[model samples]
Structure formats: C-alpha cells, structure tokens
Target: DTAVSQTPKYLVTQMGNDKSIKCEQNLGHDTMYWYKQDSKKFLKIMFSYNNKELIINETVPNRFSPKSPDKAHLNLHINSLELGDSAVYFCASSRHRAAGVNEKLFFGSGTQLSVL
Candidate 1:
C-alpha cells in the first residue's frame, strides 16, 4: 500500500488555464507539505500545513496555492497557469518533531504538470 498518494499523476494544459492536484497520506502524520521540482531537478517547498493549519509558506508565486482539508490531505491549485509553472509537484508528510538525526520527508508519488 502507498503511504502517500496524489491524483492526476500527469497534467497537460495550455498557459492561462487553471488546474488542481490532490494528495492524501495514510502515515498518520500531522504535518503535510507541497513541493515543486523543476526540470533541473531542483526541489523546493511551497507550503506546509500542520493539522489543517497553514504553517509554512515558502514565498511561492501568488498564483500557486495550497489547501489542506485535514492533516492527511493537501491540495494544490494554480490559477492562470504559466509555462514556468510546469514542474513535478510532490506532496509530503512528517511528524513535525524537533530536529533529529533521522529527520526526513515522506513524499508522494508526484504530479507532473505541463503547461504549453
């Protein structure tokens, strides 16, 4: 069974279109995050939510938004999608414990977004 899962693994749309991606985790974690990976393979966090409360916003573009309905779910929405927005979006979760030696991110499969 997948510990984390996201819908629309692949998305292709024209610029100016709007799209959304959904994610769900079963790891019983209290913190969920949204990350974006560019074609260069640079992964950067966009948002994080703990117990359905927004905790971290990584200064992402205003067009990008993240919403968490609950601790185990995080959804991303992009309005007026642009070509620069094409990238793989990953949903992740963690226990949000104090920094430790084994701290890590549990990421979902990922959703590849393509804007043309």
Candidate 2:
C-alpha cells in the first residue's frame, strides 16, 4: 500500500538527455506537487496540479514540465537535462488544494537525478 510512489529513485545520465520522473498517489488527495531539493538541502516548489489542472509554476526552467493525467498522479518531464538540474526530485501531495500552506506535505522518497 503505497501512499505515494516515484519511479527511478536514482537517475544517472549524461547531459542533454531527456528524462522523465513518474509519480503517483493513492491517498485520495486532490492536490499534487513537485519539489526539488538542491545539494544544500534547500527545497523549492517547482509545480503543482489540482484535479489535473496546473495551479503553480515556479521560476523553473522551460526544460522542466509537469503533466497530470488524473488527480492521483503528476509526472515531471525534463528536456535537455543539465548539470544544474541534478537534484533530489520529490513528488508530494496534500489532502486539500489549499491545505498546502498549513498542512505538511507527504513526500516520496525522491528521485536523485544526476546529470553527468
């Protein structure tokens, strides 16, 4: 019984390759998000989707795109992967759409993406 799942927990690849990280939630949540944590452990919200509609797009590079086929899943697709993009990509979810501000995020173990 996985509450949230993200594939390729460790991704190592050469630069300029296109890669995608998949995510899924079985917690019956209405909102899902993607977060990136750098080597310094500073986490930043990348994108968020509610009911398959994008609600937040942070100051991320155009190479990064998020897709949600349904409310339970949100996947991250990265084109022209670069060294700067190497970070721990986390998939998170909340019970309510507006509950993020107050509620703690339920995060996946994370996809440690490494661009060589």
Candidate 3:
C-alpha cells in the first residue's frame, strides 16, 4: 500500500504535446496539493484542493490544470507542453487543518517531465 503514487516517473516529450500525470493517496486526508520543482530546486505550490474544492492557485499557466475526483486523488493535465514546462511535479496530501493550519504534507516521489 502506497501513501501516494505517481506513474511515469520520467516523462520526455517534444513541445506542443499534451500529457497527464496521475496521482493517488491512500491516506484519508481531505487536502491535496500539486507542486512544481524547477531546475534550481525551488519548490513552489502550483495548486491545492480541499474536498474537491480548489483552495489555492499560484498564477500557474493555464496549460497546467489539476483535477481531483475525490479527496484521495488529484491528477494533473498539461496542454501544449513546452520546454519551459520541464520540471519535477510532486503530489502531496495533508489532513484537513484545524483553523486552516494543516499538518505535515505527505509527498509522492515525483514525475520528471522533460520537454524538447
């Protein structure tokens, strides 16, 4: 049993193609998030959802969209993937916060996308 799992750890593709990364969490958490780690190793939150309701949008490109079927799964869909889009995508989950302060986040290994 995995706490969180993502497929295709390495993704290599040309520009303008569309790709989707799937993520699932076994933890019975109500909050899930997506993070992008750039070449410089800067981790930034891309999006977050609580109980299927979006809670955060950090000005990411429209090409990147997150879909959460339930509280345990959040998938990312990228349209017109570009070279600049190359990065490591991480999926994370946390228990619902009491008064908006969540507990430690559990993260998936990551999906590295390479655009050429």
Candidate 4:
C-alpha cells in the first residue's frame, strides 16, 4: 500500500466550479501537508497540519483550505477554482514536525487539476 494516496489523479473543470482533493496516509505520521505546484513547476507548501493545529503558509491565498479531522488524513479544498489554480497538488506526511535531516516527506503521486 502507498504511504500517501490522493484521489482523482486528473481533474478537469470549468471556471467557477468547486472541487476538492482528498488525501490519506497510513504511515503512522503526525504531520501532514498540502503543496501546490504551478505550471512553472514551482512547488510551494500551502498548508501544514500537525494533529490538532494548522499552519498556513503566509504566501498561500485564502482560497486554499486544509482540513484534518484526525492524524491520518488531510483534505484540500479550493474555493472558486480559477485558471490560475490549475496545478499539481501533492499530499505528504512526515513522522513529526521537528527539523531533522533524516525526516522525510512521503508524497502521494499527485493530483493534476486543470481549470478551463
């Protein structure tokens, strides 16, 4: 089984439509994250949640939201999906939030979102 998994590997939608990408991990991790990769391949951490609290990256827009009901899942919801929102979203999880060289982010295959 994959450590991290996301649904709808490909998403195609028109402008103004709302869509959600779901993520789940079975790695026994405490920290889960959502990242967005734009057309330029610039990857940015959009949200990071550790158990009960959420930490949003300052640069991320308000349209993006991350919800975690428990430690093993993190779901991403994009509001008013726009063309600029088109990108590959990645779900990842790590053992903990502590900064350690050995700490690794186990990522899902990724979801490709295209807004027309």
> What is the alpha-carbon lDDT for the whole of candidate 4?
0.90
- What is the C-alpha lDDT profile of model 1 across 1-116, one tens digit per residue? 89989999999999999899999999898889999999999999899898999888998888988888878899999999999999999998887744467667899999999999
Clashing pairs in 1: none
- Rank list by lDDT: 2, 3, 1, 4
Per-residue lDDT tens digits for candidate 4, residues 33-80, read 998898999988888999847965657777887889898999988889
Candidate 3 wrongly placed segments (more than 4 Å): 97-102
* Model 1, runs deviating above 4 Å: none
- Tens digits of lDDT, candidate 2, 33-54: 9999999999999999999999
**TM values, all candidates:** 0.94, 0.95, 0.94, 0.95
TM-score of decoy 3: 0.94
Candidate order by TM-score, decreasing, is 2, 4, 3, 1
Looking at candidate 3, the ten consecutive residues that score lowest on lDDT are 95-104
Instruction: Answer with 1 or 4, whichever has the higher TM-score.
Output: 4
Better of 2 and 3 by TM-score: 2
Candidate 3 residue-wise lDDT, 1-116, digit = tens: 78999877999999999999999999999989999999999999999999999999999999999999998889999999999999999999988843355478899999999999
Candidate 4 colliding pairs: none
